[model samples]
Target: MSEAPLAARPPAQQDPLPAAWPDHLRALPALIEAAGLVSFDFFDTLFIRPLADAEDAFDILGESRGIADFRARRRAAQAGAFRVMQQEKRGEIDLDGIYRCFDGLPDAAAVRDAEYALEQEITLPNPEMIAVFRAALAQGKPVVVTSDMYLRAPWFTALMRRHGLPEVPLFISADRDCTKRDFGALFDLLSAETGVPKERILHIGDNAASDIGKARERGLVAFHYREPRLPPRCKGISPAASLARALIRNHQQEVPPGSLRELGFQKGGPAALGFLDWIAGAARRDGIEHILFVSRDGHILRRMAEQVRPEALPPSSYLLGSRVAFTLAAMTPANFESHLPFLLSGADGLSPAELLARIDVPAPGASVLRDLGLGPETRFRHDQPEPMRGLLKAWRWEILKIARRNRRGLLRHLLELGLRPGQRVALVDVGWNGTTQEAFVAALRGLMPLDVTGYYFCLADSEDARRRRALMPMESLVGPDSVSPGMLAAIHANRVAAEFFFSAPHDPVIGYRDDAGGVVAVEDPGRAPTDGIQAMARELEEGMLDFARHHTGWTRRLGLRADPLGLAMPLLEEMADGSWADHSGLRLVRNFDSWASSANHTMWLTDYAARP
Candidate 1:
């Protein structure tokens, strides 16, 4: 049977028109109240291509002969042909005939691939629309999606779960052996399943003919979404939602009562902050009173909030956004809620679970991983390699992935120079002349067994009271005052041997001066100290390469590895300070950027005993 004529329903007698909507668009909140199930388009309406620039595509996979030009033309043709196909489909044309018509287009295969790639590639959804979904669930409305494209159901369902959307039902034209314009089959199936009158339902979609016009042709109120750049096919459409939001704004209404306190609805944790901008906007529009943010990393939460409100976000908006606002006391699930209140009250320290619990709104104690049905190894799939001889293998993948040829060459230089195991070395890091003893101590701790020690002289304006104050915090909490440079110098002079000397990349080269005013040799007690330093430097150079090869895989996998050789090249150049004279036993391996670059702070060497 043909679909019931939506136009047959008698129109409601008009009530005195209130202030017309700003520019006649219905508010989103008002639209939801006026209807039951709202339909939406999936692709462009809900999700968007993350790469805005056309060149971004070519940049990702590298250049190919004629690839860029081919891609541009193919996209243009596919879009034009798709539009024609859409019109024909609305007139009930056969799908196979439509496909055959497009088969003759120039670069038809390329066009098809581009269209498929839109689905195959990763997509980021509009955060604002997701908030609308959550708001609908909060109102106890039944939600379903209808789509023209043959999208994988589980994938979209997982996408919904990932974005903090409640798990709900869905419908697709492909599943029903139908297409977008086949409203008769779709509406009949939905009406029978939901048992809601067709008039009570409202459809909102970006498509003009298939979605808005067809739904309007039936008895239901259909709205044209008019949102820019909506994808061709989608099911969950709600044009009324935007109008509803505006209505809520115009009425200055409180959010539907008990929305926040509703069952199975709580705060989100780490992932929640990922969508802060979306949540904050929805909360503001819905008049949400409080928002709670929970995360193991307070720093991340702070960053999220900073991004969302920047200048205006306070703690009491629709959501509570914080580091650990839930269960802070317990390590396990059994004791989680027991300690939740104390943690929220700041009486307990933050725990990891509490952090996650505060952010998640899933069924309470619901294993979010299991609820979404993701595999345990999903996160590690990209990093793990096939087993070799029954043991996990981590090949050196990181260094090889470096984009710049110069950077890779520099890394090679440093690897050739690093200190090997069982070798002694002396390392010195330069900072302010007399400011940070902490830096010296840290260097000593990190560069262990290498006889590494930082050297700095005392500040000129030293005082006893200040020196004592500095020492007091460490020993007696009331003992000495702040430390003075003179006190430090005195302590060092008495305890440290004069044979030891400080090295500085920026310092003037001082040693024994020859008759020509050129430096000859460093005079010391039997020259043993200088000889030892040189010996250590030599071993460091020889062992560098082997260590990098063995450890590259581990470092890259953990994101803790750096190409010391690569990072070192720039650093060595900086330390040279424009003096490029060849040293007998040492070569500039890498010159890492200084703190000024905010990238890495390292300068490396290839040989300590010989100059290259």
Candidate 2:
């Protein structure tokens, strides 16, 4: 049965044409108006192979034949065949002639069949060029297709027909044993066969030598169809996608909505993947066997790490502890005196109940409150330190009791995770002052002898963080050298948003307590407020994963890997500067006192304002 006509098939998706055409193609209308006929060059002009590189089709063909080194062998054979053709000044070689270069190959016929099948799978008509063909035909202009490929004329006609193009007169190099590259020979043959005037015959194609240079030399009006160049250092899937992007942009058209989303994800996802890879590599290098991702902020990072490099990374777990939880749990009589500064710094005008809530502890019993000469109505003000000091002295004993219990519970939880003495462990968090690490180490001292290190995304240049880094080895993926001042401010101002994005679907870790089973983290029954923020976070998270998957595949194909720091720094900067996406109206209502106490107060209030 005959195939359906091009007009009878379903209309393909239409992409907007570019506003301007190349200088060569710009003369097409006048040439068509004056000419008796117009001819098109196949391959890159009329049809684009779905593969990134045409040679990749051979790789697929080899794989189908179960040849382990098919790609290398195919490359060598093609090179040899082309060299012979070049030496003899011949047009082209058929599949049989090319395969002759591989003398040791078994069942050459099977390989030929595989090549045909792969071609059929990867070949796709260029929709924009096809539209041009349709328009020319509508204008009563006769058109034909001429190609320098090894495929037979009948095969080329059939392929075009299958892709919903008119079955125009077809010419192939192998069929006539002469190519357009051989100067005037092919054009002379075409003109004699079609009875068209040489000057009036306009030919459009992608190759500069065989299509434009040679066609013009033979007196045919030639238009050069330039293919978009792939980005530098791009390989595998990236090259193909990047080329497509160029084509879309050159057309002065927007990409499809789905493609836009995919590209956005690609920008961010690779960074996350790169960072995870870096962390895994660092852990291995340092002989760190356990990775403890701190609660809330570490939640999404841990998930990304598991997805990207599950087997390559060391064992990981989410340790449910926050700055508030750890700091409060680490407090005691000896340290309470020192921590009084931090605790009371932002305590001005706070009621006794409110102050206790900030400390992650329940209000003391009525009898304890009475003994401290304080009631629920009493406010802790920084201006009057005497009464607050008296109350702290009275509450010191009870506070110590609570801290000791929590510290023991924390130790038990560590033991449950199989944390052993002298083992190296790394604590991961979105860093500020490294308070969580210090609090954790202080709680663990004399309780366990494990050596601990801290890995942060970025560390604030603060005295406390510096002191902690001096005593305990610490590293940051994003630091002063990597982030700009504005970007750092945006990041600092959006801590709540970051926490919401990274946190698990659970409540904050209030404290830890021993149970019949063992040490268990105590959590609030209510879930974090995530109605609006959840959707945004999920969109970003999904985009990151998708990009990572594509980037990782490309890296693997090219036998090279991307640097995590290089990938992560730019992404973080974009996100921080609000240049990534419009985050208007997204408010982080919760106030973080970390900003007030730290030296990094350059954060802009506009960053916190609702987007218009």
Please report the TM-score between candidate 2 and the true structure: 0.57
lDDT of 2 by residue, 1-612 (tens): 342222222323443234465444576666666767778888878777634456656545654577767877877887888888888877787776778888688987778777876676556666667666665676667678888877677677668768766666766788777789866578877787778878878888878898889889989998777654322222443322332222222222222223323333534454455556667878988999899988766766787777766786788888877765676677777778887675666666565555555544566776777787877677766778766667666666766666777788787888888888888999988777787888888777778877888888777656777788788888876655566656665765544444433445455675788899887776543212333434445555665565555555544543343466655544464456554334332332222232122221222223443221
Off by more than 4 A, model 1: 1-26, 50-122, 150-152, 182-185, 228-612
Per-candidate TM equals 0.28, 0.57
Q: Where is the poorest 10-residue window by lDDT in model 2? A: 594-603
**lDDT digits (tens) for residues 136-188 of candidate 1:** 54555565666565444565676666655544556566455455575646665
The number of the candidate with the highest lDDT is 2
Worst 10 residues of 1 by lDDT: 261-270
